[model samples]
Target chain A: MDNLNVLDIFKALSNETRLNILRWLREPEKNFPAQQAHLPKEVSIEGGVCVGDIQEKVNLSQSTVSHYLSLMQKAGLLEAVRYGQWTYYRRNEETLAKITKFINEEI
Target chain B: MDNLNVLDIFKALSNETRLNILRWLREPEKNFPAQQAHLPKEVSIEGGVCVGDIQEKVNLSQSTVSHYLSLMQKAGLLEAVRYGQWTYYRRNEETLAKITKFINEEI
Candidate 1:
């Protein structure tokens, strides 16, 4: 695990759309059923949803969603996995735990 | 407890100075000993440190510090108690715990 930068995490979460993306990722199966249905059978969707699906759900431009996800990934709030041409993103549970610990014990 | 406004709390914590202020508030005796030493013998300093002491410690204009403190207080990250003419501020442990729970359970 890398050192968690508290300021970066806070900055990544400061925007409503970015925050919503995190929440929506929390229950991907329920929130992104359409994306799940269209998954390639050979490749598991277990890693998480692709950026295109996330963009569709959030109703934002591809570039904007990618920017938000990039910020979140850099902040350690998200984990990205690349499968062939598509990229999947999911909540970084370890980082989230660390953030929880920070709030509980630190500032 | 009030409905924890996670977005507002994130916005409140987005600044380095504000974050440092919260960390400094964690140990009033160590961080603001001078303020502790100057407390009126009759009045209790138990609530927290005064605004003036916080402003001096942060080395910012009174208005800037006040603005920062106000934002933190409104976000439920800090609690302010008015004593006579001065207002003392301290971390709101309840809200902090709620935030911890939020990150653990929610996003």
Candidate 2:
């Protein structure tokens, strides 16, 4: 995340669904309550939601959601952690803060 | 610029050239010094540069640059003002500040 490229970030965010997904991740507890209810306590990570849960919420195919999440992760906008067979994604606040700084001071 | 859409802002910034154009506009006097040298004093607006001058520096065809500028203007990232026959472009700081706030708080 050292050299975060603006074009990559922008490209990752260009899609409306991707933007909504990022915003939803901001308040996971509120936005993903249903998913949280069924998740085993052992598998849960604060602010992190499983890929299946995200796909369910977005109503997109698993592959599509995975692709979007991968793009976001590549852009340093989201961090993905694999717990067993499932991948959980959470917003990368450090990178997000850097992006805000970039917007304020750079472009 | 009441309802600044995040998706639109991201779309406007998705291209490398457009991103560079926005960054270059940040320090127009330094980046576009050659264009400034020959401009008539009467046509100068603080922080504003003509479309032709911007196109020359970008090395893009006039229409392509205009399309990019128009898209940026529509997204509220830029302001376009017509001066006689030439259109002047400048960063819309107010909208830019709003976008930064959106990134920091909303997203």
Candidate 3:
């Protein structure tokens, strides 16, 4: 991984909607409903929180939540997995550790 | 500190100018020139990197750089100090740790 600016990481995290999505993923069972047809099973596992459950919690249109998740994933904040007709998202622990070390040593 | 959204922090850090300012702060000696008028001594200390040096490195107007630094500081990414006629800024370690932990545990 390249040198990641603290500001860049912060910027990616600055949105209310995006923040809620991340928080919801922390406890998938409590925050999300059971997986439906459009949901992925790993929404409760390692892969990620299912897109449909995320959409429901954020109360946004499916497309908008999807876009926001994509942005965070692109910035190395979230990881995505596809299964059947659904996509699941989860935090990337490696990047999380790197960000912590970066802030500790560089910032 | 309240729960911080990863996206909110990321959004604050996304700008190229803000990113460069942070990078320069990592090694104040090599990145900034000798402090001149309107520059603070803590550009080399725990207090922070001077505003003028940040202005010079980012190649932005004084007002713009000042605003950007203030925004990051507001978001709990940077800490600012006002001394004499200059302002110096440094990262806020507490907030940084919080952010890293939030990403690890929540995201």
Give the best candidate by DockQ. Answer: 1
RMSD of each: 2.1, 2.1, 4.0
The lowest-lDDT stretch of 10 consecutive residues in candidate 2 chain A is A34-43
> Per-residue alpha-carbon lDDT of model 2 for B1-107, expressed as tens digits?
34887778889988978888888999887888665444577757667788888898899999999999999999988998776687888999988899878888778
Badly placed stretches (over 4 Å) of model 3 are A3-10, A36-47, B3-9, B36-47
Better of 2 and 3 by DockQ: 2
Please, what are the lDDT tens digits per residue for candidate 2 over residues A83-105? 77878899999888998888887
Report the lDDT of model 2 for residue A22.
91
Interface RMSD values for all candidates: 0.9, 1.0, 3.6
DockQ scores of all models, one per candidate = 0.83, 0.82, 0.50
Q: DockQ: which is higher, 1 or 3?
A: 1
Q: For every model shown, what is its TM-score relative to the native structure?
A: 0.91, 0.91, 0.76
Ranking by lDDT: 1, 2, 3
Alpha-carbon DockQ of candidate 2: 0.82
Interface RMSD value for candidate 2, one decimal? 1.0
Error of 2 at A106 (Å): 1.1
